[model samples]
Target chain A: MMTVIYIVYSAVCFAVAAALLVVALHRACKARIAARSERLLAQRYVRMITALLISDEGAPMSRFAFCGRRGAKSVLARALASVSRSTCGDGCGVVRRIMAANGVEGWLLGRARRSRGYGRARYLSMLASLPVSVSTANFVGRYAGSRNRHIRFWAMMVRVVADPAAALYVLSTYPHRFTAYETAAITAVLRRGLLPLACYPLLTSPSHNLKALGLNIVRMFGMADAERFLMDIISDDADRDDVREAIFAVAAMHLPVTRGEIVARVRGMSLSERRSLCRRLACEGYSASVIMRLAANRDRHYMETLVASYKRSLVCCG
Target chain B: MRQVLIVGDSGVPRDMVAAAAECAGCAVVCVDDMAQAAADCKRGRFDRVVVIGSAPFFDGRMSVGQLRPCGLQRPELYVIGWHQSEHTVLGLLEFGVNQYIAFPVNLRRLCRKIGAPIFRGI
Candidate 1:
């Protein structure tokens, strides 16, 4: 009985090892094949895209039409997206034409619709880079109200790209506050073009996040025309984050904030706010006297530390 | 054939730039290492060297500042997130950059900057 048990155990162990080895070999082979195919696709895409860009005729478009074939759509989409991202002006127009010729939009929309969860979100996010079209917007708009926040976020991005003029409106109505990642993504989109003329509404929105976004847009775009709106926010009782953003925007744009205005704002602000304003003003090359005025009745040690740090930074930069 | 060298890590679309340069009738070489790029530039083989500013070169080991001294001819600084700031422009100019091309790069302009004939259909 003991001998039989030992033989059975050895047989079981050998069988398990053999199965594991087969699985490992299969996986390695699959990976190698995938890598090889990917390399070939990359080489083909380089040749095709370069020829397309160099050729004066539309012959390359028909060549790119093979993107509709099985397994090639994703690779083609990725290659074209890379090309589109690295180019602007007439080059971008050329890429757009290629995408159109290849039916990339329809493939992406179909994939996004069929996919679930993260897969769906991935496809939607990819759509953000493509040129805006009515059909794409209509499809993406259905998901703007999705329960999944990721999908909703990407859907909103597509909508924003589809109609940039209504960006503020789309963002202000979002059910949740914009996360840092979301803010950065939206900022990237806005960076591609001038901020819409209707951005003023974001400042006056009830949501603190929207107000913060507005302040950031103002700072980034150097919208000096919004100085009056920023002044009102500084003086009014607003969210601390909004106030901080407003001050930073004011300092960044170098919009003339009078000493009287600063003093008045300081009077209504908390000690921390006063400290932040002083530090920002000092960094922006404001006079020491003005910084001292802002620092009045606050911790002298903190003020000294801030001034010392600022001087150290200036020296380091120089 | 004009030669162009692109120095950037994975964050940059080096392959795309290479393809564009190739289409514009130039031989393109891409390297992720600053040392290798400096070495290539030292040979004076490349007509233009494009340094991507988006890569993480902050360790003080190698930087554009170091690469500028490699006797590079027509070094173009290509930076993403390019804001219209005079200070930033002047800073790049001080780095011995002959051109500051912001993303998304105008391929036609890039070809002209690199002394290559712009493609007819590009």
Candidate 2:
């Protein structure tokens, strides 16, 4: 019994020591790899940045060549990203030209095709940051309908880059409404001076969510003509939710629309939407006639929102 | 050496951040979820906490909310992701997150933020 116990203890000690040795070896290897990459990164990064600024495509590619094709691609990827963030206007155009000159577009397309789901998503994101090209845009569009949310999200960004109007259309009709990321991405794209006037027609879209998105786009872009679009949509029998969104947008923007036009549309809207509109109108300091009319409707929740807004306005005005 | 607590699933970005942290002469402890990160914050002393967002966090399905109560003593919170919105960025800032970095990971900015002087030129 004593001999058996001694043998078991020795085996356990050996096993633990082996595991520790493996861990130490693995960490050392990782450390070495990191040190090597950091050294390579330090040597190559500044040269690439300088070459990109000059728009001399050959210089960046040649500088990257010192790192070999694979290493060069990694370095260029970082440089491309840095340039994308730090510069804009024709400078961005220069960076894109340099990227194209480096064969990044083709390499990205190949990466997109050959990589698995996550790899493909990463490449799609990289492609989105580049200037839109026919092949990259086409490749991204094919994945816009992908069931994987990551692929769809990145594809939408690429779509927004390649064609904002078409992307807006896709968002309007997409079965799934915009996720927060999608909303932010679309907002960012539209804020990049993409015209909102073109998306006004979508206010009449059959999807209520799409209409809301249209209203948001209009609001974010501050298309003043959109007031006419909003009034027209509400004047017709439109989704109460969408009308609420427009009113919210209007109030958020502090844009003035005819209060009478809004009051006229309220009879057809839901109590909740009417309440929201009342709150907005009150907050925007619209005429008392409209506020009193909605306040008189007497749904308790609706009344509370309006009354709260009215009271807050009084506090401000008083 | 600076000690960083990285909160996120195991992935390329996480690994990159960890490697970067190490290269900066900092020690890294990685936890796969917020709960683990919270627990580590109680038990560990860290100089920075980097909440690396994966596709899920960027999708708005997940968040690293309110880091102040996590027992971290003066650790700056940095978020790294791809394509986070201004609203999200502002929200993170408001919630006491120190920085939100939208990727392809900016090594110079990242190294600088972590006090990693190894990048040299930046």
Candidate 3:
């Protein structure tokens, strides 16, 4: 019985060691295979995609064959997607041709419909990098409220880029408030002043965040074109948050387009309202005298800290 | 051939780095283990150094402090990863990195950023 017990213990030990060895060997093999595939992908598909992007060449037979292969197709898809955003002129034409040749565009659209979670996110990200179309934009717009934050953000990005006014409309009307990161991503696209004229209606949105977003975008794009609507929004007894956003817009406008109207309104404002405007002006680096005078009127202690904050901002920003 | 040093331990796929560098007409020298990257720095200079993976940017092992002691100089440094906050990207700037290409490196942006002049069909 003692011999039998010893034998059993030895067998258990041997099995455990052998299992560990097999796992280690399997991992090593996988790593080696991955490395080899990467080398092949880099040498074969990456350069071809790059060449197609840089030149006006049509999709070659090589790309068509690569799409049929297992490892090569994924490599081709990812590499093509990577360059899609920057492509323009003939660059876009060539990439589209390559995708057509490989049937990648159809595969992407098909996979986009079937996927969920990361798979869907990846497909959407790839789709965003492609040139815009009504169908693709609508497909992305469908996920604007995806339970997955990543999917939602990327979808919002696609929609916002495709049509800012509509996206912002949906964003404002929806109960969801985009996280700061999502807001920044959407804003970056609109920051360049490409907003459609339809943004005017959103300024009156019942949603505070949406109204604030519209005010900020109008301010950022210098849509002095919206000065009339802005004047109305500023004068209206709008949400305090919306009013604060208007104060920021007034500050951003600087010289007299709407500055006179803003100054006239400021004289009738409350202390808290004055404080909010002064804080925004300070942050936006409006002329120091304006903020300093307001700070002094608020309180001596507030003035001292406000002055210090301005000094720090100047030192850091400069 | 133009050479670049890529330091990371978090298993960022090797193909991504190689494709980016090669597309820009450079070759990549990947150092999988951060300690080994520090050791390798002593051997020679690289045209560019890319740091990726893990948190706090390059972590303590692959920080500039370790690389500088080994006499590496003037190689353009880049930090690439998924950044949770702008503060972390700003913190890396304090370390003298040349650029921070966040994760899902925009290939065209990366090419333009590195001054490759390959896109624009130019």
Candidate 4:
């Protein structure tokens, strides 16, 4: 009985080892095949892009025969998107023409519709990179309120690109508060001339996040015209974050903020807020006297120490 | 042909910039590391050093004083930034960068800046 049990145990162990080996081999083979295909795809992309770059405007569209290959649309889309992103002016027009000719938009829309989860989001992101078309916008709008936050974000992005004129409206109504990453992404899209010709709408929006974004835009573009609006936010907006953003924008743009306004704002702010404001103003090259003037009697000693320390740090860094 | 050195991490933008430069009749060399790029500039006579991407600049790695230590031959420095702010532009100018090119990169303008004729065609 003992001999029989030992034999069975050995047999079981052998079978398990054999299965493990088979799985390992299968994975290895699969990885090798995938790598080979990726290499081939990369080579094709290089060839296609090189040809497109060197080809003349009058070059026959038929010469890009690879566009018609099965399973090449996604690869082609990626390559074209890369080209389009790295270029502006006439180069953008050239890429758009190629995408249109190959029915890339329709193909992408179909894939987006059929996909779910991350796959759907991926397609929407790709679509966002392309020029906004009425059809693409209409399709993407359906997913704007998707249950998945990821999908909803990408859908909102597409909407922003499709009609930048309504960017403030779309952003203001965003169901969730904008994360930093989302805000940056949206700001990048807006920079692409998708809309919001003026940031006045953003400043006027009820959403604090949108208002902050508007302040950021003003600072970024050096929009002198928005100074009045920024001052309004500074004086009236109760949201600390929005107020901080407005203050930073004002400091960055070197807008005139009266000493009385500074003293009043500083009086209401906590010690940390005062410190941050002082640092920002200092960094923006505000005169020592001007920054000192911001300190209320209660915070004079603290403000003096802060200014001295900041100056020392600057010297050390330099 | 003009020799151009592109300093940036490997990305679509850097690759496209290299391709555009090559198309415009320049021999392009791309280096991912700022140190390696500085070394290459010392080793080769690059007509222009196009620094693509903002990481090196914003991360406080590449600076005007740092570039001097590399002994570069005073090649025109161009920084291609994605959505650069006024502060960033001023900083780049202070760092002795010849120009600040914003994204999406205008390939034609880039070609012109490098003193190369714009390559016509798609």
Question: Which model scores highest in DockQ?
Answer: 4
Candidate 1 chain B least-lDDT 10 residues: B113-122
Candidate 3's residue-wise lDDT over A151-177, tens digit each? 876775566555655765656655566
Q: Give stretches of model 3 more than 4 Å off.
A: A1-4, A7-11, A28-47, A57-66, A69-72, A87-90, A132-232, A237-246, A249-283, A286-310, A313-318, B1-122
- Please list all clashing residue pairs in model 4, or write none if there are none: none
* RMSD (Å) of each candidate, 1 decimal: 5.2, 11.7, 8.9, 5.4
TM-score (C-alpha, index-matched) for candidate 4: 0.77
lDDT tens digits by residue: candidate 2, A1-318: 999999999999999999999999999999999768765564355444543443334433333454454456655665565445433344445656666666767777787888878878888877776676765787677887888888877877776666655765656566676664666555554543442435766677777656766777776555666777777776664466666666666665566544776656666676666666776677666656546665535764565566676677566533
Q: Write the per-residue lDDT of candidate 1 for residues A88-158, one digit (tens) a residue.
A: 55444555577777778888899999999888888888787666576698778999888888899999888
Which lDDT value does model 3 have at A200?
73
What does fnat come to for each candidate? 0.37, 0.00, 0.02, 0.40
lDDT of 4 by residue, A1-318 (tens): 999999999999999999999999999999998767655664456445644654447554543455666567777777666655445554445555666778877888899899999999888887777775766887788998799887899888778766767766777788787776777666666665555546897898778778777877887788888988888887888887787778778888886655455457766888778777877777776767777776556666776676787787666655
Q: What is the C-alpha lDDT of each candidate?
A: 0.69, 0.63, 0.62, 0.72
On a 0 to 1 DockQ scale, where is model 4? Answer: 0.40
Residue A178 lDDT, candidate 2, scale 0-100: 64
Better candidate number, 3 or 4, judged by DockQ: 4
lDDT of 2 at A175: 64
TM-score of each: 0.76, 0.51, 0.53, 0.77
